[model samples]
Target: MAMSRNEILDQVKEVLVDALGLDEDEVTEGATLMGDLGAESIDFLDIVFRLEKTFGIKVPREELFPAESLMNNPDFVSGGKLTPKGLAEFKARMPHSDFSKFEANPDINKLTDLFTVAAVVNFVERKLNQAA
Candidate 1:
């Protein structure tokens, strides 16, 4: 009884559209939640909550956004920018996110901006797989 990728994306779209007051068209897989979709930091919490409710899965905040963990790791950050190792780790952690722009500059403060609609789909899939 696992959900297909499209099913997950559709549910994710519903949550994002309702939570952020976004149009269905704007919540595409490549759409960055913060930069492209106008999602603020507070909206992140709402998104997570709605995803958990819709999917019946417990997604810890850190799992969706690991800024706190990254900041605390010296090897991951230095002088407010991501180290080479940090960039690799970030890519590994968030494979679903589009890192094209973020990789160019790698600003720690703007890390959340890397989150795309596809990332939510990946997260939900991982959580569901884990539960199974």
Candidate 2:
């Protein structure tokens, strides 16, 4: 048996609420982990650990958050914004994220927007399906 999307989202919310010290209502599908929920880099580790423990799935840090690598590459990033190549790589790497708004400005600071609660749910759902 597989968990439904809502179930996955509920678990993700729990993870975020505990890991980020957030109220349940703050962890909405559209909530950006960093921007909206105030999740620092360290919180991500706790979130991943909790998600893995809760779901019994391996959660790779880079697999879920590939921004660090992409941001450092000159070809991918220049002038504090993502180059076209960077955008392409981001799209490939962050398939779970919504790129519509980011594609417009492509500002490096906006990279945090890519890490939404829904994206976490999507990644967990994909990982669980793969395990199944």
Residues 18-110 of candidate 2 have per-residue lDDT tens digits of: 898888988889999999999888998898899999999999999999998778899999999999998999999988899999899999999
TM-score (all chains, Cα) for each model: 0.85, 0.97
Candidate 1 structure quality by residue, lDDT tens digits, 1-132 = 989999999999999999999889989898888889998879999999999999999989887887677788999999999999999998887766778888889989778777888888999988998998
lDDT at residue 122 of model 1 (Cα atoms): 90
**Per-residue lDDT of 100 in model 1:** 85
- Give the winner by TM-score: 2
Model 1 error, position 91 (Å): 3.4
Model 1 per-residue lDDT at 14:
98
Candidate 1 residue runs with Cα over 4 Å from true position: 98-105
Clashing pairs in 2: none
Query: Over all chains combined, what TM-score does candidate 1 have?
Result: 0.85
After TM-score superposition, the amount by which residue 98's alpha carbon in candidate 1 deviates from its true location, in angstroms, is: 4.5
